[model samples]
Target chain A: MLLGVNHKTAPVEIRERLAFSNDPGVPYRELKAIPGCEEFTFLSTCNRVEVLFVSSKGDETERKVRDFLFAGSMSYDEAGKYVYLYKGEEAIQHLFRVGASLDSMVVGEPQILGQLKDAYRTSSDQSCTGVILNRLLHKAFSVAKRVRTETAIGSSAVSISYAAVELAKKIFGNLKGKRAMLAGAGEMAELAAQHLLNQGIAEVVVANRTFERAVNLARCFNGKPLAFEELVPELAHVDILISSTGAPDLILHKEDVKPIMKKRRNRPLFLIDIAVPRDLDSKLNDLDNVYLYGIDDLNNVIDINKSERDKEAVRAERIVTEEVLKFMLWLGSMEVTPTIVALREQAQEICRDEISRTLANCKDLSPKDQKSIEKMASAISNKLMHHPILFLKGEDAPEDQRRKLAIFRKMFSLDSVSRQDNGESD
Target chain B: MGDLLFKGTFLLYLLSTIIYSVFFFSQNKTVRKTARMFLLGAGIFHTIYLIFRYFEAGHTPLTSNHDIVSFFSWAMAWGFLSFRWRYQIKNFGSFVSILITLQLIVAAMSSSEVRELQPELQNILFPIHASIIITAIAFLAMAFCGAIMYLLQERELKSKRFGFFFSRLPSLDALDTLNHHCLSIGFPLLTLGMITGLIWSKQVFGSFWSWDPKETYSLITWLLYAAILHQRFTVGWRGRRIAFFTIIGFVVSLITFWVPSYHFTGL
Candidate 1:
């Protein structure tokens, strides 16, 4: 059973309220009292809060889990309006999609895969996941890997920092040995600088209103801190300038950037202004060899990247569907095989008893005739069970397969074997 | 025998060109690997063809339009393969292969008849000069590819449309770096080749600075490249502007190499 509320359903207020504040290990402590929950794993992220658990009384367990999470503030019916609950096959499919990032708000984002792995790992360490979930989660991970390798979904940059880096690439061609200047030590600007560094931008210079803040931010990234007054001079040496200062007025004007472009010998300069009021004059973009992008531009790039990823998602969806079917087939065979085997064993045992009784009574028959009679009896039972065995193993829809399996077990009185195979007896 | 090898090389290049186009669209790892293998195979056959032509003609095979164009195509393929081996830009082979095949087709259209080497072309410096110049042209061709990619990728980034070409092409930084690397490699070789040609001209024609159309064009091509290199190092001229300059340089080189060789007998 899977119960979760993601960004698509719940508002941030509700999600944060239900989130485990500090300890991710709190679920196991609380789940100890929930009866019939054989295994449990809780996943809480910025975008989602979920619990995947194995329980014989799935409906009751879901209610209890919801009550525990919402803490009497909401009932199951009210929660059902926002929360998604998946049982058996639906739950498995949900896990696969989540692992593949198809269920993510950002369709092809890579973070969900790693997050899923972390959730699985943490749960396993806490003894909350066992044989079934262990196999299922690992399968989900491999499916995610396959999706990543087989499609171009994760190839483009879709975030602000990434978009800035991508724009820098457009202006300069390659960032290797190129220098980047951070006009403000704002978090967004710092993120863009880090992205540039990862793309092989050789040097980073951070300039902030507060010298100490600049020094602290620069030290974190192993970068150099530049004095705020030196921003104009430092622009000459850097290929990219990311500005996100909180100043009321513009920090850079056309006049300030024109000379820097000249000093740099008309080398391309990329200006990324992430600040709301915009740190640089828009007219500075008109300078030759200068490319300027504000926050809106980065968002546009992200939108483009997201749309491209959405197209590739069609292919990824097909792969997920194929994997889900394969897992379901494996699961179906797992649940049905023991009952089929038990039924066949019962048939064979009855055939042997009937053959033994006939052979003992028919003393006049030759030893060869007695053996032929036993063989005939065995063949009759095998022929009778052949169609049933084929039906048990054949490809049917999940619902139809379940119905047939239940009927097969009841008809043959094989509930004990089925229950044993399921590791449950009720 | 040599003609058979030439035809084999041409067919292999054609096959590889198609495969590379597929690789570009699909971006499949297996298809990329196969396309690269085909390019290598074509290069081998092309090398053998060039060697056979050299042995058959008893000189470096840059005497006629057909020979020189084919030789240029061979150089481009070899240059592209070396770049790919070093940089591992798998998508780049699509563009380079198309350019190579286009050159080969132009070569095929021209008569393959061997022409007698003119008196001034017979000097030892002529072969050295021609070899270096042709190799440089190959590098410039790669630079041209990089420039085109840079412009297209830049457009994608600026417009935020993120279309098929955007996904298919490498990053702007990578393309820019490729363009820069190509320019650096090509410029010096071209300079050396022009100097050698000047020396050869002095030895044959008693003048090192003749204003022949071909020589004038070579000078123009050389100056354009020099300016590009200068601006790149000093003024920090890069990306779209540099890419455009490299493309213009390639066109000028083509005209200088092709037009003068067909119309003029000697330098």
Candidate 2:
């Protein structure tokens, strides 16, 4: 079963209230104390908090998990409005989708897969997952890999800072030796600068009205701090400039940039003006070798990329669906009763076939003789199957039982026959 | 033998161009490697063809229309290869191979008949002057290709609509640097070629400053490049404006070489 609140189902306020801490032990101890919670994994990221659990008392354990999630924050009735609960096949499908990143806020981002892997690792370290979850999570990982390789889900940029980095690559070809300057030290600017640094931009320079704030932001990036008044002079040296200052009017103008272009010998410059009222003049884009993108322009590019990503998402979702069916079949086969039934059915079919063939070969045999032969064949087949059935029915830990059932099915090739039967029934 | 070698060289260049075009779109590393090998083979075959033509013609092979154009293509092939040895510009070989193949096609279409050297053109200065000028034009041709690529890429960046050429082309900075490198070498060779030609003109024609059509056009092209180089050094004129000027200089130089006139014999 899966119970969770994601970006789509819960607003930030509710998600923040229900978010779990980074310490794996806290959730492990608290959730393990529930009356019927058999196994569970807690996953908490900025956008969602989910608990995937196995339980025998389904509704009762689900109630406790929900109450535990909302404890000290809200009543169970109020919290129910923000959470979604899935059971059985729906829960399996939901976990597959999450692992494949289809359920992410940005559907095709690659981080969710890593986050899911980290959560699974922590859960297994705490001895929180059993055989079912171990197999399910492994299946989810392979499904994610299939979606990644078969679809173009994670190729395009869907975020603002990513868009900026893409544009920088187009202009500079390589960002290894390039420098970026943040004019205002705003959140958006800082994010863009961070992305630039990640792309291997050699240095970052931060300048703000408050020199102290500039120093702090510079320390975070290990970049130089400059006074706000020196942003224009600094522009001559840097390849990219991101400005999100609170200034009401434009800080840099076309006239101001023309001289800088001469000073820099006309190296390409990429300017990002993310400020609301606009810090850089619109005419800066008119200068030779200068590329200026405002917030709206970057958003427009991101919108285009988002649509492209959405087109790829449709194909990824199909892969997830196909994988979910395969996983569900595997999950169904994990039951010992089905394996035993299928094994016995196969032995009886083979015994009946041999007895009929033997009866046909001995044309002169009496009806009583033929019946005896059939009874003897049935007794021999039962004797041959008795030890295997006993092994399958032996009392063992659930994990060991699942392992034995898997091995027994493989030994007899029972799953293939069952699959053929399924195909015929369909 | 020379004709067969020339044909083989032409075929090699065509094959190289085809492979390079494939690599441009596919961006596969092994495909690029194969394309470079084909290009290297073509360059070597062209060199052999040039040597064979010199032996068969009983003089320097750059005297005829076909020989001059073929030599121009050969120079371009080597110039591009030499650049590849030093630095890599993205998808640069694709464009340059096209240019070299197109020049070879033009050379093949013209008459390959070898003619006796003219009385005035039989001096040592003839081979020296013609080879230098053709070599300089090869580098400028590379600049022309770089300029066109720059314009295509800059338009994509400016319009904010990234189409086919956006990722396939090199960065604006790289393209601009290409133009600078080509010009830095090409401009000085051009100056040297002109000085050698002037000294030869005085020796062969009795006057150095006569305004023949080729001379006038070469002067015009030279002045244009000089101005561009001057502006680039002093006032930092680059990118779009320099690309435009480099393109114009190459066209004018081509006209100077191709337009038939009476003053330059056998050209």
Candidate 3:
């Protein structure tokens, strides 16, 4: 079962109230104290707080887990309004979706997968999860990997800084040996400059109105500090310039950049003007080899990228569904009833095949004789399957029951057909 | 045998062109590899065809309309392949293969009859001048392809449409570098080809300079490339302006090839 309150269902205030500390021990201690709770793993991220557990006492354990999560934040009825509960197959599907980042606030972002792996690691390390969760979590990790490889969900840029980097790549082909200049100390400019540096841009030059701020920002990037008045001269040296100054008017003009292109030997220049009242003139885009994108333009590119990711997300979701079905099949096989049914079906199939082949050879036989032969074959098959079924149904610990079910399925080769079926579907 | 070889070469080039076009749209890596293999095969077959024609005609095969245009196509194929060896420009082969196939179609349509060598044109300098000039034109043709891609990519970037050409074409910087690389090699060869032609003219026509239509147009093309190269180095003219200049220079060079001259009566 899975119980959680995420950004979609809870406000930040309510989410913070239930948010656990970073120390895994604290949450595990509280989670362990919940009555009737079996093996469990607790995941707390900025966007969600979820508890994945395996328990026979379903309703009681769910109530207790909810109380543990709420913990004086609200009444039980009010807490139910914020929390979502998924049992059985739904719970498994939810876990797979989360592991694959399909349930992320920013869909297809990679952080959720790492966070889930960390959560699973903590739970397994603390001996809080048993056979079911161990298998389930591993399956979830593989499902996430499959989704990542089979789709392009994580390839497109969805954030502003990433959009800038994508555009810069389109202009420069590669960022190595290229230089970027941060025209102001604004947060957005700093972020874009950082992204460029991460892309292996060779140097960064920070220029702001106040020399001290430029020096501080430059130090953060291990870059050069330049005076704001020298920005135009620096344009000749840099391939990308990000400006987000608080100026009411444009700081750079077409007239200013027209000459710089000549000085730079007509090398391509990418200008990102993220300021509200744009720092760079719109006409800068008119110059040959000069690409100027204002805030709106970058947002437009991000919007397109987001749509592209959404299309890929659909493919990712399909992969998740496939993996969920496969996991569900495995989960069903863990149960004694399914294993016994599969064993009987396999035995009957073998009997039918043998009887039909024998009847085909003795075509002179009467219908009554053929019917007698089919009855004898089924009786023998039933007698053969009786012991294995009894052994699977024997009363034992839940862990031993799982082991018996696995052994029974393997002995009869019952799951082999279903595995082949899955492969054929793929 | 020569006709059969030429037909085989044309078919191979056509097949490679078709595969390249398919790869351009699909962007499948396997398809791209297959397309490149077919193109390489076509290049080899074209080389064999040219050698066979040279042996059959018992003279350099750069004399007839069919031979000259086919040589032009062969030079383009090798030029493109050589560039691929150095650097990869996205979807470059697709565009270049289209040109090669079209040139072959022109060669196929024209007369392929082997012409008797003109008595005066029998000098060794004749073949040298023709082959060098055609090879130089081949590099300029690649520059022409790069310039068109540069313009298309520049339009996409400037318009911020992010449409079909945006992701498919190479970067503006890469395309510009392509133009620069091709021009740097082509212009010098073009100058040398022109100088050899002048020397050949002095030996065969008793004059160092002539005002033939082909000569006049060749000078114009050379001057245009010279101006473009000069501006690129000193004045920093690049991107759209350089792209346009390259296109114009290539068109003028094509005219230089087609204009009636004492040297090429096969047309």
User: Which structure among the candidates has the greatest DockQ?
Assistant: 2
Report the C-alpha lDDT of model 2 over B113-192, residue by residue, as the tens digit.
98877888898898999999999999999999999999999998888877899879988889999999999999999999
Predicted model with the maximum lDDT: 2
lDDT of 3 by residue, A189-295 (tens): 76678667867899999998999878867876889999999999999999999998988999999999988988898888999999988899888888888899988
Regions of candidate 3 where Cα sits further than 4 Å from its true position: A1-147, A185-191, A210-222, A311-426, B262-267
Over the full model, what C-alpha lDDT does candidate 2 score relative to the true structure? 0.88
RMSD of each: 9.3, 6.2, 7.6
- Regions more than 4 Å wrong, model 1: A1-5, A13-38, A53-97, A130-426, B1-57, B63-67, B88-122, B156-168, B198-219, B255-264
Candidates' chain B TM-scores in the order shown: 0.96, 0.98, 0.98
TM-score of each: 0.63, 0.74, 0.67
Worst 10 residues of 2 chain B by lDDT: B258-267
Task: Please provide, for model 1 over A283-342, each residue's C-alpha lDDT reduced to its tens digit, 9 standing for 90 to 100.
Answer: 887776677788987897888677776667888888888777766754564467776877
Greater-lDDT candidate between 1 and 3 = 3
Each candidate's DockQ: 0.33, 0.64, 0.63
lDDT, residue A128, model 1: 73
Error of 1 at B181 (Å): 2.3
A1-426: candidate 2 lDDT, tens digit per residue: 999998789875677677666565888789989987777888887678999998878899999999888875888888889999999989988998998888876556677888899999999898888877887888888888888898887667757887898889878878999999998855567667876786798999999999987886787679999999898998899999999999999999999999998889888899999998999999899988999999988997788688777778888888878777877887887898878888889999999888888888899998998889999998999999999899899998665777788788889988785456334221
Candidate 3 docking class: medium
As a whole number from 0 to 100, the lDDT of residue A79 in candidate 2 is 85
